[model samples]
Target: MLYTPAPLHIPDGFLSILVSVVCWAITIIVIGFAISKTNKALGEKQIPLMGVMAAFIFAAQMINFPVAGGTSGHLLGGALAAIVLGPWAGMLVMTAVIAVQALLFQDGGLLVMGANILNMGLVTAAIGYGLYRSVAGQSKTVKLTVVGIAAWLSVMAGALLTSLQLWLSGTSQLEIVIPAMLGVHALIGLGEALITVFALAFIIQTRPDLIGEGSESAKASRNWVFAGGIVSLLVVLLSPLASADPDGLERVAKDLGFLSVGQDAPYQVIPDYTVPFLGETALSTILAGVVGILVVGVIIVLIARGMKAKS
Candidate 1:
């Protein structure tokens, strides 16, 4: 059988229209603020960094590693982004990644895109940056520890927010959904934490200036950008090896009997990360992932440049 990766974000029909609209309003307002903040503070070096971060996150998200209970999980990248790009630009990069996932890959629902961005992008970036900032001037070990905690908490926060949204949409009972969602996600969060910590550790060792406040002082270098693009492409090449198990939300929805309610995307474009003509082959997934990373990277770069120009 062809392996189909389960849905990674909230799909249409999973939440009520009212809830979606509310999420859209909140996301729009926050994103607008993010744009303003980024425009004012964005540095020349940070612009390309945002693009690289978005591309890396987009590619990394395609590789869902197993997390137990027949479930799988992937890096959210918000913590890493926030730590590297700061909160405002981090939000923009994450927003670009999620938006592209929904629009180009059909990985998430268009109508529920706002909720997905809010949960996975804004909330994660905020929490990650908030907690990480607490360790300013700390030792490297201390900083890594805090980053791991922040990343784990970010996943938990995303899970909690998702549960609330499901409850508010009347998709499941609050009592059952909360434990179910959080329980499974606790394991998933570990995976998130590990990936985040390891990625940060690598950055700190090879390019210490890329982390946190150091990013502002770092000079722009084409070599770093080239290296980042290579890493993202390497990740995409491994896309076919990603576990095919249902992700946290998908498993939760299935267990709670609401899986059937998830409506399909109204249209298809590289649906399921497979080029239609390629017919579910490994090459198809890799090709689609490459396209995703390139598209998200360029989009983020363009957005960052625009913000910089305005500033």
Candidate 2:
């Protein structure tokens, strides 16, 4: 299943406040570099796609699946976003997604923003992309399968990095967490692959032109961008049956009893899902999805506009 452990985000108390603050600092630094780097490539137009991808991926996360034991989690979309937009834009988009999830969903702590961004954003966008280009370089024939594999590998890589970070923090035994993380993530990676492949396949069919123009510039599609917006909106509107089975990371952490050492602290934001008109359960997820989508859409438009980037 998962190539990595249950690392959607380190639950509360796993990291210290100092560690959390450091993480945010790192995120800020990396983002500065990321923005500059993106501007260098396709100008500012690429910025909007970052926001668009974030909304799309955030919405996708709303739909959870059943793992082995009834625990559930949603797609990270790092690989999918990277593959679609290329690494540079992918990192930016992923950063946006993670940031919003931290702020709104409270899925990941605000304090650990840096570590979270690096784990999900840079790792998935950069590492996964490097592997894809290296292995499948321009092979349009097997692009779907290749991308499927890439998405799987990307999730695995992200999870592995997360596990490593946890290990570095000395939060838990890496020996226990690493295998648990990888095994569960391997399965979860399958879901990631399917989603990415299907989405890419659809894009290829309807608007192949939306892909890269040369290197990784202008890798935006009207349908996919719209589909991303629409699908995310759909996830917001629909009642996503998030699986109850502990996600790969959570499963491993539980199996190893990481929870024993890892404390579950109270959140600053109660009812993490406090969207208007949404209850405490699944409907909140829908409300979060919709609000997240619209917020991200506005952010994307603003970024693109600022960058003077094209759609």
Model 2 has an lDDT value of 0.61
What TM-scores do the predictions have? 0.65, 0.61
Give the backbone clash total of model 2.
27
Error of 1 at 206 (Å): 1.1
Error of 1 at 301 (Å): 38
lDDT (10s digit) by residue, model 1, range 255-300: 4433333322223212443322333454454576579778877865
lDDT assessment of candidate 1: 0.68
For model 1, how many clashes?
0
Each model's lDDT comes to 0.68, 0.61
Clashes of each: 0, 27
| TM-score, cand. 1 vs. native | 0.65
Candidate 2 lDDT, 1-311, residue by residue in tens: 21223355876567755455656677688678767767887766656756777788777766666756777645778877777787667878888877776776677776577888877787666544644443333456566776777677667666666665565455756557666777778788888887777877888789988865356333333222332333223322321111222253354444443333333332532445233333354455556557976886787556445534431
